[model samples]
Target: MRILLHICCAPCSLTVVRTLQDMGHEVTGLYYNPNIHPVGEYLRRRDTLRQFQEQMGIKVLYKDNEYDPQIYFKEIAFREANRCFHCYRIRLERTLFIAKRGRFDAYTTSLLYSKFQKHDVIADLGRDLAGGGQVGFFYHDFREGWKEGIEQSKAMGMYRQDYCGCLYSDFERRKKLLSE
Candidate 1:
């Protein structure tokens, strides 16, 4: 299957892309994370993903116009408490749209690689987006290789972010630290 993998960042992409390749899927990366907040963090993730693409010899599609944080903010407007669903919705929707456009056999997301992210939410969103339509959603429990991705990314000297990449998430992360 030719897969269009939605990459959240370089570190997370490590295992997912490898796993997809190992499964005999031709993988192309799609970098479209409008949910990532703060321009600098977003740019850092994008740049690191670019480097990962170069080193891993994978083709990555960048949608700079969709990188606007405002799109994310608007998506979650007045619904900050359940922002994860909305965030995943926007990303997976975009990925499926691009998957159809690019004629990919299936689409998956590096978001599944993160222990911090809600797997059920992401999987449901992906399935809902695909809807047995022109494109298919590849669902895998990528968290199994979370440690491997961390170790390899560390070896590669990639910038691993502590937060989940949104202003609310940043605040929540800081809150946990302050409470601790």
Candidate 2:
């Protein structure tokens, strides 16, 4: 099946790309993460993805939007409890739109590969997006490949980020360190 893969970063995309290809699926990667803070970090992530796509011979559809923290904060607003729901909504919504326009047989995301991310929430958003757009959400728990994915990316000398690419995550990470 032809699939539109929402690639969050190069390291996460590595396993997803290889796995989907092995399954005989035509994959096109989409990169859109406005949540990543600090323009330099965003650029680093984007460049890493570009390098990976070129080296791996993958077709990438990159949307270089401005890094607007307001979009992320506005979504969370006073309801920090449902921050992830909003985040998933934004990202998957964009993926669904791309999948519909690109005429992909289905769509999935590298976010599924994150052990830290709320996969169920992402899955729910993906399903809703697909349903609303009449597209299929290929729900693969790519977290199964997390260790191997990270190891392979490290072996390939790819930059590994410690944070989850959001200002809130960054603050939380530091807070955890301080408490520890």
Candidate 3:
């Protein structure tokens, strides 16, 4: 399968990329995250993924370089409670679009590897986005490699973020820190 994996960040992509490649699938990464707020953090994560791509000799398509937080804020402002679903939809829709254009056999995401993310929502969104499309949704519970990915990333000196790439998630992280 020629898979277009939606890479969230370097740490998350490491395991997913490796796992798919090991399964004999040709994996190309798609970096289309518009939800990562605060320009600096976004750049850091993007650059880290680029570095990883270089190290692994993988082909990665960078969808955007401009940081547009207003777009995200506007979409999720009133729907904050279900913000993740919207976020997943936006990214997955873009991925499926690119997958079709790029002639990929299937699509998947590194988000599925994150325990902090809404796995079911992402899976459903991927399936819906791929419906009636030429590319199929490749489902894999990558959470099993979470720990190994984290440790490998640390060993590789990659930048590992604490939150799920949004202002609200940043606030939630801070709240958890204060409570702990």
For each candidate, give its TM-score against the true structure.
0.94, 0.92, 0.93
lDDT of 2: 0.86
Worst 10 residues of 2 by lDDT: 65-74
Candidate 3 lDDT over 38-60, as tens digits, reads 77888899899888797765899
Estimate, for each residue in 113-170, the C-alpha lDDT of model 1 and write its tens digit. Answer: 9988899889888988888797889999999998998999999999999888899888
Instruction: List pairs with backbone clashes in candidate 2.
Output: none
Q: How accurate locally is residue 153 in candidate 3, as Cα lDDT from 0 to 100?
A: 94
Return the top candidate by TM-score. 1
- lDDT score, residue 16, model 2? 87
- For model 2, the superposed segments whose C-alpha errors exceed 4 Å read 176-180
Instruction: Rank all candidate structures by their lDDT, best first, as comma-separated numbers.
Output: 1, 3, 2
Q: CA lDDT, every prediction? A: 0.89, 0.86, 0.88
Question: Relative to the unseen true structure, what is the C-alpha lDDT of residue 178 in candidate 1, on a scale of 0 to 100?
Answer: 90
Pairs with steric clashes in candidate 3: none
Question: In what order do the candidates fall by TM-score, top score first?
Answer: 1, 3, 2
